[model samples]
Target chain A: MPTREINGQSIEFDNEGFMTDRTAWNRDIAAVLAKEEGIETLTDRHFDVIDFMRKEVEEKGTAPSIRRLNKLNVVPTKELYQLFPGGPAKKAAKIAGLKKPEGCI
Target chain B: MKKLLILGAGTAGTIMVNKLAPVLDQSEWQITIVDHHETHYYQPGFLFIPFGIYTKKDVIKPKRDFFPTGVEVIFSGIDIIEPEKNQVKLTDGKVLSYDYLVIATGSQIKPEETEGLVGDGWRKNIFDFYTIDGACALAHFLKYWEGGRMVLNVVEMPIKCPVAPLEFEYLAEWWLTEQGLRDKVEIEFVTPLPGAFTKPKASQLFGDFLDKKNIKLTPEFSTGRVDAANNKIISWDEQDIAYDLLVTVPTNMGDDAIARSGLGDELNFIPTDKETLQSKAHENIFVIGDATDLPSSKAGSVAHFQADILYENLLSAMEGRPLRAQFDGHANCYIESGFGKGILIDFNYDTEPLPGKFPLPGIGPFSLLEETKMNHYGKMMFRWMYWNLLLKGAELPIESQMMMAGKRV
Candidate 1:
């Protein structure tokens, strides 16, 4: 197990650098994790996606996929891609403190 | 006495050996099948392993188990094929001369051909479900994973089981939902083809399915290289798509021995008469399955259909009779669409997969180009057929040639 320290809080990660526990996540931890994922700065739009994911997880017991977010008009497809750069769903989930998705892509 | 040497005892070779062994007299014709490995893998089952629908026990059996008594099996890697001399040289330095040769060594996935594909993130975040090891490794990695963006991309065309990557996408969607993570994972089906599939009509039908499923379809993007460190695949035209997890079908190439023997095309595939299955380079040489560069789909059903034609033609050639049998390149595939449902598609060299009933003209138990629970069961039930009926050369009830009676014009 590997641990990342952000703002005096310790977060545990698996072998692939994904967070082990969802409860250890906070705004400060997300900011630090986002920087590690190649996003140097988190904008308000970024938080909006992250907050949406966290809130979705709390309500639906899982984070919202980009398709769902797009369907609900919470985020546009182009803007979602722009916000996360590479993989919006995975990056947003990781920053919001969730596990990596399993199975063949 | 004549020597009939068959190379690589996989699907095509096994079927050839079984189909011809009893028919051809053992005293006059010595039939020998050569392969490097003893185990025969039910390759179609490989796709289900990563999703936990299948296991190792379901797919593997000994090659000797299915081979008949009269046919001799040789376990050794082929070093070179001397088609000019009608001889084959093994890796062990043994030379076997043959009067006739049937090349059945199939195509293989070449991950090394892609830059950075086998490096850094291979088996970590980048995985291919084409092989046993690759599938098992992916299964292990996926067990504990929560959810993210999963991208399934095909680097090029002419790969074995072309529809498999799409099947994986469909299964993933179902699996994610079962895990209560469907909303957490965004899946993308990426390919170099212009649409969802190779055939035009089938592509349109499948394109609609992708849309309804909300799986993003990215087509016509030629992959240049994988940026594993950054988790993005770069296209030749400078387009890049990022993924938290990347599933790739690397370039498929025919056996290397074909290239060494100077008897193959650019991709090492044996150039054969598309109708007769006879090698264009040598009259005594024939090719079937993924080894031939025919315009047919590289699939088991095509090989099964080709086997019937090859058997009759080869026997005719041996008897000094006109080779009357011809192959129309019939291919049948059942596409698994997840949620315990699938779609069936049957076509040949000239026909695209059209909507209709299969086998029977108007009253088919199985429908074509339409998803049905029966079709999924058909896909599942095929494992038994592959092991007992198909590899054993048992004639299926389906016709060898493509029929247009039931298919819509």
Candidate 2:
């Protein structure tokens, strides 16, 4: 339950630094997160994935995986990697205030 | 008679059919199990196929071998499921309606989902061990062939038997060392997860093992496409890892029938209530094994654990009682670490794998989160138990819910 002054608002994150209070996230915080993820400027394409992820999480109670995003033609997976860089699914999920994708050990 | 239809005569479905058939008053309940395939492959044994440790005899068996008497077995392709009508139509035009349905058509590898995966080099240079054919093919390819860059890539998260890929790598490391070809071969494990495993403690341990074994680790690699012609797998971000022989666990998805039924997530995994084991969309329908989109390890142990709760809950549902049996998402797996040693991990949805003795607490015949020869024997001996005791629905000594009795936090 670590709180950070993100976007001039105190926001909480888990030990992994994924946002805890998902409701505390906003467009401004997304920019900060995007910058932290090495995307200095948030573009429309970035918002597209972030928004789609947020909506999917809202509806399905979980973040849609990269495969699902590609399967549904939400975004071309290569573009998703280009947009988020490094780990697109995990990084985009972090920016979108969603938990790291759930998987069994 | 009220009809109970069980889809997929795999481990979970078969277990349910056996457990319920004798208990549910045969006169009142007409139990029927449907599956397209006649053969029931011991899926865990597939991991040994590539190393010449096991062959067709160990993995393959007639599906009917496990079915209890009086349960109708239909061997035919599943058409679309009419959930609204409470019926499933076979490809042969017969429709079977049921009061309660259990969906357990397990997950399969979708190599076609990735670009260049199924093309020219497939079963040649690129291979998968998740299936009997793939394992056998890899076994053939490995025979008399000198190794080079051997890359094992898990294309995505939530693949069936999450530990198998690591085990494959470890076994390769051991087997190659045995053959004295270890010096010439370079081993690399590429995965979507940040490390060797989902849990932090176990991941660290497995990561250390990989390091000690001289197998390289490539973490958070979201596989985009297989560059078979070039002998490399390119991640979505275009991070490419070149391999002479690529053993890829291409996207594991639920049955295509789930997609046709429109009762599944994008990956065709049924949206199931994790605790109740009931379909989120249809109350009369329950999902088990790799078919459910529960955040549990897609392994036999999970299905075995789920079978107990599903049994109690299905009976409760039949009697119009609230589903009191909650599935704790218990998954117990023995990771075959090779060199005749393996690791045992027991965990649930809430708890991560911890260092402890299992089942018997301090006096456990099996240790948790540590590599031991006893654990290896436990893994090997499971094959017999799977066929004899488990699929027969005999009560196992282990509890379905994960316990903190012996675990060190």
What would the per-residue lDDT of candidate 2 be over residues A1-105, giving only the tens digit for each residue? 889997679998999889987888899998888788888998898888889999988987888877789888889888887888787878899988888766545
lDDT of each: 0.87, 0.90
True contacts kept of 2: 0.86
Per-model TM-score, in order, reads 0.79, 0.97
Question: Candidate 2, residue B289: CA error in Å?
Answer: 0.8
Best by lDDT: 2
Which run of 10 residues does model 2 chain B get worst, by summed lDDT? B220-229
Candidate 1: lDDT of B378? Answer: 88
Question: What's model 1's lDDT at B308?
Answer: 93
Chain A TM-score for each of the predictions: 0.89, 0.94
lDDT of 1 by residue, B200-233 (tens): 8988988888888899999876676899999999
Error (Å) of candidate 2 at residue B343 is 0.9
Task: Give one digit per residue, the lDDT tens place, for model 2 in B1-409.
Answer: 9999999989999898989998988889999999999999999999999899999798888988899888899998899999999999998888999999999999999999888999999998989998888999999998876979999999877789988999999999999999889999999999988899888999999999999999999898888888878898887877899999999999888998889989888889998999999999998999999999898889999999999999999999999999999999899999999999999999989888999997798988889999999999999999999999999999989898998998998
Candidate 1 to truth, TM:
0.79
Q: Candidate 1, after superposition: displacement of residue B51 in Å?
A: 0.7
